[model samples]
Target chain A: MVDVTAPPLSPTDRSTVRRHRDRQRADRAELHAVLDEALVAHVGRVVDGEPVVLPTLHARVGETLYLHGSSGAASLRGDEPVCVTVTIIDGLVYARRWFTQSANYRSAVVRGHARRVTDRDEALAAMRALVRQVAPGQEDHADPPSRKEMAATSIVALDLTEASVKARTGPPGDGDAVAAGDDRWAGVVGLATRVTGVTTCPALPEGTPVPAHVPTG
Target chain B: MVDVTAPPLSPTDRSTVRRHRDRQRADRAELHAVLDEALVAHVGRVVDGEPVVLPTLHARVGETLYLHGSSGAASLRGDEPVCVTVTIIDGLVYARRWFTQSANYRSAVVRGHARRVTDRDEALAAMRALVRQVAPGQEDHADPPSRKEMAATSIVALDLTEASVKARTGPPGDGDAVAAGDDRWAGVVGLATRVTGVTTCPALPEGTPVPAHVPTG
Candidate 1:
């Protein structure tokens, strides 16, 4: 096996940008991979001086992300600009001491305009991207959204500009007590999202065959 | 095993105060179990008319949650009120259609005053609680923070008042499509965080016994 400790790239790749190591990237590829795996993102915005963070499903296609909300959601449809952040905490970094302990995470902070998708084709495509993102093969099997459903939904696209990805991994910080002969164990504890099995909706027929796409993880 | 498909609890307990089904708890006990398992929370707050969401390590002891940050950090020191939300995405819900696909998540949203921790003993107890939150036994093994380190670190305590928990699970909502039958796969893909043992810092002396306080979740 490859030495996981061996640095994957130059030291610069892991250097922090804002709050030291807290604002650094372990690797560019690592960052993108985390983004690809997430199903939703927490979007924070200030609407009339109130800060609101809304958790909604999202899809990242190329350099842009698409999020959908009800047409009546004030924060989604509000005119104020927003800052969108997508984070995937892969593991908990547990070091010897409290100060040195941190989370092993991949996060992208995006500051951009929240544009409404008015074009029918563009809006539909964004929705498709979101569906595919949450469950990879979902779009082909189900009935397309009815005109009424489409009318009720509002999609917003945020351009992925002025964004920075930050992450941290390994035993602990370089200069921590753990490195200075502190007799303590230091590593990570991982967590995962699991699908137990397919759940037939009560409204479905008694003998309905479970669609392959509907199977639980 | 219990029939998870059966209704988990009363409608009131299963629903949010806001009465959003999409944000309601399908399994009440499951929601509490998820929240009790984690130690860190990403708090969303407004700073200087802008939305700033900061990732702070936290500990939950009963109904109270303890959070710490640098006193010099503008957001934590400022007098403005803050909204702290603790979320654990249990699974990814895959619906037959793209629109119904969503995340199976458990989250607690708390709105309260972000008060600073000034008492020395209370601050220490909060730090210990936070360490034990993630790693159950490590707080006793680690050395206490020195006076200088204590002054440098900024800790905040947020009461869990005005809070609500919500969650969703199982397959996506396909309704009539599943009843009539469709030839498409629809299912969830499980993603998990896996810890792969401890990695010793290069600066550590050879053969130091690993402390028992390291978290293994």
Candidate 2:
């Protein structure tokens, strides 16, 4: 659960929302909601003086955002300046004018220097948090990472202090002229991440049942 | 319709796939498929020497990718270097080992300098293409942008010649020991963007039929 009592998101020079300022949300709960619901985040950083963006699974434990990848990855090394962004497309907005057609979405951007987690205990906890994020109950079913496996991975944590959240919801914001026109249809088509079914491994037994945590449409 | 016969995707110095070389797809068809299926893209660029990533709608016509935003947007201004990434998460992979847990996704990263479109006709066409990309049949129903509306918008185009496509599909790539273990369940929970329903404007007349192109779950 997010601590809504925490301070509202402060706008820094870079974190200030210039485009679509109406959609910029200042509430910390909105930021937490976008981060907790996202399974993957695109992390951007300067690698060898060039910008690079990579998508990886992430977990938000309270105020800190944790990211993990192979230690050898170029983007995962050291305390480098990084920008983490998570976006969820909620629905497609259709308007009677081409300029007003858009999609409803929630996005959060965090800018900070990511510190590599070298402590043994902290890395273990971060790894567990990541697993519980994607697969809720599988953390108990799966075995913890071995010592060798833990050493091979790199966990980076970014403070969520300097972050910005922007969201657009509901139907299209069409003009009065377009909205009153009956010649065209204008509305919003809702979308969601539908978990259709589960596919077990071939080595599993023929009648192995799907886990309860696995979502099915 | 992607020209599968077009030349294969040639990686430039920056577009090279480094993290997971095994999942790097070289087929141009796969690249086009990923770009077409996506409705939103994260555009990354250096603003005041800090990396900023913004989510916006995108459209691909032939080999060029087009993105439009208000001229007031700081990220969309100028012909600066940019990286556009589109990712589609297909499923969640549950493994018996915590280290092997992952998600199945298809992603495309295009690195290049985006040129701002100033030609009136080209800008109008790009806007139409973008509207068609999100709501296919709605383009014919909606009215074109007025001269004042086009002046407020900025359309930027990025060539898809230099890009990288990475994808992971099927079940988890677990080790023999983990795969053979029957103590715990291991499988993939498939996911997709399921369009649930439509919500029309209150001003819409009674019985305004839903468009056929609108997806229904």
Candidate 3:
């Protein structure tokens, strides 16, 4: 097992416990499960007194969350501390009122020190792990990163020690104000993920077999 | 029909051109289609030197994109320039190399001035439009926001005057540099936006026919 530790999958003392509506169950199991289901997360950070939030690919191994970006990413430089938030919106909640409009989502926020991944071995491993996680059995199919290529990209690994996962599932909430009346059409708009048939590049010659993983729904 | 000028479907300036794979057609079309299909966008902005990105409901009426948040949102307070990025991950692009691992996503980055919606009538219309945009038949079902409630919330409308969209789709790029001799199972792990059956609130007594527009897909 990875030498990772998090608050008892619940709220932690060092963590900020917001309202239950905004907080997800803290258990590692819940966090890991959602992370595995999600393909990417919106990463947020501040740079030069400006905020830049980039959508990047990420993966979780044990208790460590890994993020990959081009070395040219302005916000990832070693000058300041960063707050990273990863959110996976599972579905959309379509309520009658504007205020009640929300999402059926699972999100994890980590406030921690961000450092460049200098160890090449660890970076390579992390990258490979992320690759496999995103697409199972992809590591072997992919050409390993060349040293020059590896240097061109940057990877940051943050411990999931001080993080909280908050989620709101099911229909819209039943606040006192909202509960007073029940005539409105309140429900969720299911967002289904669909994969088109294998699309081939025009440049590629004919006869390429579609990989088994790219299933058409 | 709604007297709302729909923002131009795509950006005009050459700067809106995608830098990475400049020739991909699906990338461009997907960007606009994704934004049009979804009702809410995760808006990212900075406040007081801290980066905060919130998943708020959004609407695109013609070229102008509008977003509304609570008056309490720290990021929505100031008029400073901000980068608003809207992203929709269509599918997961699983590749053969760890470095090539990426998501098939559509994203638009709009760099411009954000103006606060101070006019009460416009704010109310924008808020109603936003809700209706997300759940097409919702505005009529729910009670309108009371004056106090409207005052409690802050609705900001930002023009999509200058923006660029970048999109990546299909299978992972075949890394020509590393594709010579390596052979492993390579493909994309697809994701779908599924709409699970609706679970009515306990407050909503049984058997209220699921609203037609409230999709059960």
Best by TM-score: 2
The clash tally of candidate 1 reads 13
Q: Model 2, stretches more than 4 Å misplaced? A: A1-5, A178-183, B1-5, B178-181
* Winning model by lDDT: 2
1 against 2, candidate with superior DockQ: 2
Sum up the clashes in candidate 2. Answer: 0
lDDT of each: 0.62, 0.83, 0.64
Worst 10 residues of 3 chain B by lDDT: B2-11
- Cα displacement (angstroms), candidate 3, residue B153, comes to 2.0
Docking class for candidate 3:
acceptable
TM-scores for chain A, candidates in order?
Answer: 0.81, 0.93, 0.82
Runs in model 3 deviating more than 4 A are A1-4, A8-25, A73-79, A174-184, A192-217, B1-34, B73-75, B175-190
Candidate 1 versus truth, CA RMSD in Å, comes to 7.3
| Least well predicted 10-residue stretch by lDDT in candidate 2 chain B | B175-184
The 10 consecutive residues of candidate 1 chain A with the worst lDDT sum are: A7-16
Q: Which model is ahead, 1 or 2, in terms of lDDT?
A: 2
Alpha-carbon lDDT of model 2: 0.83
Candidate 1, A1-217: lDDT as tens digits: 7544433322332122446545565454554566678766777776456565667777777666778755553448634566666677666666656666666676766556688888888888888888777666667765456787788678888765445566665555633564455555555566555554555555555555665654355
DockQ of each: 0.30, 0.66, 0.37
